[model samples]
Target: MNTTPPRVLTIAGSDSGGGAGLQADLRTLFACGVHGMTAVTAVTVQNSLGVTGFVEMAPEVVAAQILAVATDIGVGAAKTGMLASAGIIEAVADACDQVGIGRTGTTPFVVDPVAASMHGDQLLTDLALEAVRGLLFPRATLVTPNLDEVRLLTGIDVVDRAGQREAARALHDLGPEWVLVKGGHMWADPECLDLLFDGSEFVELPGPRYDTKHTHGSGDTLASAICSRLARGEGVVEAVRFGKEFVVRSVRASYALGAGVGPVSPLWRLEG
Candidate 1:
């Protein structure tokens, strides 16, 4: 009897802080009972304080990493975090297309449009942002963007649930099969309500608003959880719901580690 776990690939940057990016992604994937793989796009001089500096990998190098795994080990599902430049985004899009890892391909792709850091540090440039919307959005099975990213991509400020719906529509227009407008940054809200739209209907995913500053890797954790569930054969909606529940638990289990903010813990999965 074969006892191999499902495989999920994360094409994202590396955070030396171990709070966000591929570090968080791999952690979440492991907690979700899947084999985690990566295609590193950049390396950041980041810590709990913030990202002081970073360096992006060559476009071909990024593409080569994807090809190396997708063709041989095989990816059941994939998610992207921070493609730092336009060239990197284009390269990733081409490689994903070639390796059949998008909406039109065999593997489901989750595009997490990481625009900035939690401390308000910009991660992607305007050019790279446009590339994410034009190049990756169309190929994504699901695009998970926070409120800030929603504004950057759609020019619509998501102040309320109605605004989230509007942003979801605008994102869906970009051609992704589904859109999840994360409302974690909306501090004014009593509950953290994430809106999921699939062209026609809207699903409101509401969770307890945890009052914690240790949410450094929450976005990466959520997206990676969704990707992991997809790799485990769950449908898009179900996977998203599972992701939402998983992230809420992680946020609730969050703890401080460094001087700045710390990360949400996926170690809660061990409780069972």
Candidate 2:
């Protein structure tokens, strides 16, 4: 096996609390043995539990940053999360199209359509959602969304396994080459399941569910994990499986750090 580190880029928001968004993506990439890069579109005033406020960086700056990265160090894989506004979303989508053209097959992207915080804070506006659907999803290799996000994206209320498949298929029709309907919010027992529809096959990944409120960045972490592995040349199905295990482990070792819900330690394995 080649030991050279794969390079992954994350286009997302910054979290002052260092739990989710860019911080979580970076941590997950490092844990997975990949070099991480970032283009922060928004900065959030957030704590362990939720987002209080967020400020978006200018769209031009985001575009420039992405161009700089693409022109210089280069990216082996990329993931986008929490594009807070339509302008930034368009900028990211445009830049990613170039990245996709230049780095196709070798560099895939995992897009996490972060619509809201677990504590009910709105992170994505309807305009941004439209931007995501129209600009980003068509260019994404994989789009990861939870139940609520699935409903937002496709108006499908995924209540069970069957609903998961329906939602996944519906999301697939939206242009993302692959759609993962995250079942973390599903009302179920025994396991946490995620359904992946790659336009051709539906892959179901199931694992022991860890009951915890300390899951601030689970989606970001999982998507980043998939990015890291895809950068290392792992197949999509295998990458999703690895991402699930990584997230479960992170949740199992989640530390409640503040008054509200804490975040999973995506780099928990490296803690000494």
lDDT of each: 0.93, 0.83
In candidate 2, which residue ranges exceed 4 Å CA deviation? 1-4, 101-106, 120-122
Measured on C-alpha atoms, candidate 1 has an lDDT of 0.93
RMSD each, Å: 1.0, 2.2
- lDDT tens string, model 1, 1-272? 98989999999999999989999999999999999999999999988988888999999999999999999999999999988999999999999999999977889999999997675556688899889989999999999999888888888888887788889999999999999999987888999999999999999999999878899899999999999989988999999999999999999999998898989999999886
Off-target runs (Cα >4 Å) in candidate 1 are: none
TM-score of each: 0.98, 0.94
Clashes of each: 0, 0
- Against the true structure, candidate 2 has what lDDT? 0.83
User: What local lDDT does model 2 show for residue 136?
Assistant: 79
Indicate the residue-level lDDT of 125 in model 2. 79
Candidate 1 displacement at residue 157 in angstroms: 1.3
